[model samples]
Target: MRKIDLLFAEYGESHQNPTNKFIHWICVPLIFWFILGFISLIPSAHVAVLYYGLISVVSIAAIAVVSLYYLKLS
Candidate 1:
């Protein structure tokens, strides 16, 4: 919808700024890590350790890339 698109455009414009974007980049991965860690703690889950490890690695890599992006942007 046009309204949704307009809202997204406004949000995107704010996020396009270097500092706010960098903060989101850092926080998003950290939030994912916490969510994955929480899920891994569930008793009935299979492959919990593997999932935790994979998510951890992904989060680290995402943080690294975000840091590089921030540096370049700044």
Candidate 2:
């Protein structure tokens, strides 16, 4: 089988437990929000060309990268 197929099979097995899946539904968003809150606490800095502060730039980059990854998988 191809690499992507193998990866999906493995991921499927890992998430088969209902309790584990439930915890993932809750914890994943909580952790993501926690990380973003922490990032927001960091002192903001001005970027010369972008005009956006550091946190905004980092958040946008992260969202773009994750979106691209999901698009590729789908």
Candidate 3:
């Protein structure tokens, strides 16, 4: 009944298939890795960063963006 619940229910509707779920399990990580790889290529991405692989400032920025989207949805 709530807007966030409705959003989740709509999203869940398409994921009822087991094959789709399995494909997502594989593709999600691959896509995530691809995104991290892209972000890592940013100029000066390595200098003065107190972090490890896949945990750079750009990745944190991406997380913030996603969190903001969810916050708006909720």
Q: Estimate each model's TM-score.
A: 0.50, 0.63, 0.60
Highest TM-score against the true fold, candidate: 2
lDDT of each: 0.66, 0.75, 0.76
Give per-residue CA lDDT, model 1, range 1-74, as digits (tens): 67666887898987877998899989998986776666545545232355354234444455577679778654
Q: Over the stretch 1-74, how does candidate 2's per-residue lDDT look in tens digits? A: 88998998998899999999999999999998887777655656524455553445565556678789989988
Rank order (by lDDT, best first): 3, 2, 1
Task: Rank by TM-score, highest first.
Answer: 2, 3, 1
lDDT of 3 by residue, 1-74 (tens): 99778888997998999999999999998998788779766653433545543445676677688789878876
What lDDT is reached at residue 8 by model 1?
72
Query: Model 3: how large is the Cα RMSD against the reference?
Result: 3.5
Q: Which stretches of candidate 1 lie over 4 Å from their true place?
A: 2-7, 48-74
Better structure of 1 and 2 per lDDT: 2
TM-score for model 1? 0.50
- Reference-based lDDT, residue 39, model 3: 76
